[model samples]
Target chain A: MYEERHHSEILEDVLQFIYPLIILFGLYIILTGISQPGGGFQGGAVLVAIFMCRYLVSPREMGRLDLIQKIDKLILVFILALASMLILLGFREVIPYFNGIYNMLIGILIGIKVASGLTVIFYTFAFIEGGKED
Target chain B: MMPVVEKIMYIALIIFAFMSVQTPKLRRAVVYLAVFSAGSAFVYVLLGAPDAALAEAVIGSTIATIIFLSALQKYKAFTVYYTNEMRHEYRQSNLFRRRNAVLERIENFCSGKDLEAHIMYTTESLQEVMKNHGWDIIVRRKNNKFSIYGMEQNYHIEEMKKYIDENFNDLRKLGYEIELHIGWSENE
Candidate 1:
C-alpha cells in the first residue's frame, strides 16, 4: 500500500497558481448558489478539487490529513448543531431578524462541513499508506 | 447548443469518481483517485468554480499520493493484508537484518556447538541465586538487549524466557512487551 513519493516537478509552481483560482471560482458559485442551480455538494466537490490537484503532481509531499481529519470531524458536529438550531429556531421561535442571522450562520457552517467532508476523498488514498508492522 | 456534451462530461466525472472507489488494490485505487481528482477539477473549471478545481488538483491528488507512498516504505510496503482475519503466526525475522558488534561476536564464537559450556550464567547476585548448569551461559553488561538465535534448537518459550531471567545483569530485556516467534526447519 505504501507508495514512493515522486520528486516535485517544475509544473508545481504553475499548479499552485491554478488551484487558488479554482477555489475562488467555487466559492463564488456556491455563495450565489441560493439563486443558482448548484448547491452545497457541487460547491464542496469543487472545493476539494484544489487538494486533489496538489496530490496528483506530488503525492508524497502531502501530510494535511491529520489537520483535515480533525476539522472534518468538527464540521460534522457544527453541521448537526446548525441543523438542530434551524429546526428549533425557525419553527418554534418567531424571530425574523434571528432567522436571517441563523441562515447566514448555517451558510458558513455548510461551507466548513463541505470542505471538511471532502477530505475523506483524499483519505481513501491515505488509508492505503497507513499500516503498522512487526 | 451541444448540451449533450456537457451532460456526457458530467456523467464521465461521476463514473470516474465511482471507478476510483471500485479499485481493489490500494495503489490502483490511489491512481483512480488521482484520475478522479483531475477529472473533478476539470469539471470544476467547466462549472465556473476554478478555485475548487485548483484545490482538487493540489491537495486531493498530490498530497494524497505523497502520504500514501511514504507510509508504505516503513510499514506496509507491498505487504499483503488479508481481509479475513486469520490469526496467523508470521515471522518478521526474515525481513530484518542485524549489524550489531556484540551479535557479531556471538556469531563468531567459533568453538562449535557448545558455547553454553563456556557461558557462565550469573545474575551478578543483583537478583537471583546462582545455579550451576553444565551449559556455560555467559553474557555480560546488565540491562543490555541481546539477540540470540537458536540453531537446531526449538527451545520452549518458557526456556527462552528463563535465559533472560537467569541473565539479567547483561541483558537488554523486553519486559511485558516481548514477542516470541518459534521457527523450525519446516517453518519458513
Candidate 2:
C-alpha cells in the first residue's frame, strides 16, 4: 500500500501549464505520424505519459478509466477485423490512394488503442497502490 | 560525423545500462533504463534502421518502463503483526492451525483486495512494535477479545472494520468482541 503524497502548490501550477502542452505534443505526434518518423506506437506512448503525469501530480483523483479499457479492447477487435479485410480484398495495384488511406486509418486506430490501453494500465496500478476505490 | 555520433551513443548506452543496474531504487533504475533505450534507438537510427529505432524508442523506453514500475509496486508487502495475549509455543505446524477467525477474515480481505499479505504472529507487545519496526496493521488479542489497530488513513482497514462488524455480529454470544482502533501510524 502506498500513501498519497501531497505535492507543493507550485508543482501543481507548473503541471497545469506543462500537462496541456504534453497532451498537444502527443496529439501532434499521432496526427503527423504517417508522414513523419514517429508512428502510432511512439505517439501513443507519449499520450500514455501524459496520463501518467496527471497521476503523479494528484493520486487522489484518478477518475473513472473503465471506459478507456473498454474502448481499447474494442479498438483491438476493430484492428483485427480491418487487417482481415485488407488481406481478403487483395488490393493489388487497383487503387493507388487506397493503400495510403488504409495505412492512415490503421495508424490512427493503433494510436488510439495504445493510448487507451496504457492509460487503463496506469489507472489499474494507481487504484491498487494509491488505494482509490475506483 | 555519423561515426563520431555513433561512438558517443554507444558510450552513453553503456553508462546508462550500468547506472540502471547499480541504482538503489527501482524507480531510478527504470529511468536510467529508459535513457539506455533512447540511446540505443539513436544508434539504430545512425545505422539506417529507422523502423527498429522507432519501435525501440517507444516500446523499450516508455511502455516497458511503465510496466516495470507497475510490477515493482507489487514488491511492497502488506504486513500484519498479530500478537496473542497468551504467548503460545512457536511451533511451525500448529501456527497455521492456531489462527483465529479474525486473522482468517483479515487474510481473506487482503487477498480480495490484491494486497500481498505478510502476517507475522509475534510475541512482542504493540508498544514495542510501534516504537521499533515498521508495520501496517497490528492485531492484539486479550481473553477472547480482539483489538485491531490500523492507520487512520487506511481505507482497506476501514473496510475490514465494516466487514467484521457486519459479519461477526452473531459472535457476541460467544463472549468475543472485535474492536477496531484507527490512529496515526509511523512511516506515513
Candidate 3:
C-alpha cells in the first residue's frame, strides 16, 4: 500500500508561476468586493484554489489544518461581533461614511473565513480521513 | 446567436446531470458531476448571475470533484496477488487465456460488490507474497492446480469462495484442481 510519491516537473513549474497570481487575484476580488460583483464568499472560494493547487503539487504535504480551523472559528466570532456592534451602537446612523469601510471590513473577514473553512474541509477529506485506510 | 448558445448550454446541463446520476463507476460519475457544474455555471452567467456562476464554478466543479475523488480513493479496494510457479508453462497461449478468464470472473464479482479490483502479477513465490504483502486474495498456480488463499476476517472471502465453486466447474472438468484455503493464517 505504500508507494513512492510521484513528481511531475511540468505541474510543479506551472503552479509555481501561477501561485502568486492566484493569491493576488483572490485578494483583489475580496478587497474590491464592496464596489464590484465579486465578494467575500467568491474570493474566498478562489483562494481555496491555492491550497488545492498545493495538494496537486504534493498530495502528501498540507499546511497545519488545526491552525486553519482555529482561524475559521476566530473569523466567525469576529464577523458576529462586528455585525452586532454595528446594530447595537447605531454606527450606521452616526457615521455616514462608515458604511463603505464597514462593508469592506466585513467582506475581507468573510473572505478569510471562507478560505480557511474550505481549506480545512478539503484537507480533512483528502488527507486526515483518507489516511486511516492506509 | 445568443439564444442558440443559451439553448445549447441548457441541453448540455441536462445531459451532464443525467450522466452524473446514471454512470456506474463512482470516479466517472464525479467527472460528469464536475462537467454538469461547469455547464450550469455557464448557464448562470448567461442568465446574468455572475456571482452564482463564480460560486458554482469554484465549489461544484473544482472543490467538490477533488473531495469526491479523494473519498473514492480511500473507498473499498480489493487487491489480488497472482503467482504462477510454472513460469515456462504459463507462456503457453491457452494457459494465459485461462488465467485471464479467472481474473475476469474475479473482477466481475468485485464490481458486483462495489469493490475496485487491483490484480498484480508477480514472479515472487506465493509464500513470499503472503509473508511480505497485504492482500485480499492470492491465486497461486502450480501447473493445473490453483490454490486460492484468503483471510478469515475478510467478509468477501466467503462470497468469493461460493462464486468460484459455482462458476469454475468447467475448469474442474478440464482436469484443473482449484482449492480454496479460507481462514489462512498469516504466520503459516
With a 3 Å backbone cut-off (N, CA, C), the pairs that clash in candidate 2 are none
Q: Rate the local accuracy (lDDT) of all candidates.
A: 0.52, 0.78, 0.87
Q: Is candidate 1 or candidate 3 better by DockQ?
A: 3
Which candidate achieves the best TM-score against the true structure? 3
By lDDT: ranked, best first: 3, 2, 1
> B1-188, model 3: which lDDT tens digit per residue?
88999999988888988998998778889999999999898889999998889889989998899888878878888999989876723355764566566777788899899998888887788889988988999988888888889988899999999999899998899898888898755565
Tens digits of per-residue lDDT, candidate 1, B1-188, equal 34666687778878877887885445566777777778777777777876567556756676555556434433322111111113223244722453333433332332122222222223333112112222212232323333232323433334544543554433334342222233324322
Worst 10 residues of 1 chain B by lDDT: B76-85
Error of 2 at A73 (Å): 1.7
Residue range A13-89, candidate 2, lDDT tens digits:
88889878877877777677777777777777777877777776776676768778789999999999989988897
DockQ of each: 0.07, 0.18, 0.61
Task: Compose the digit string of candidate 2's lDDT tens values, residues B99-181.
Answer: 67777777777767767677888888778876776678898988888888888766677787788788777666688988888
**What DockQ does model 2 achieve?**
0.18
Tell me, per candidate, how large a share of the native contacts it keeps. 0.12, 0.36, 0.76
Q: Which ten-residue region of model 2 chain A has the weakest summed lDDT?
A: A1-10
Model 3, C-alpha of B130: deviation from truth (Å): 5.7
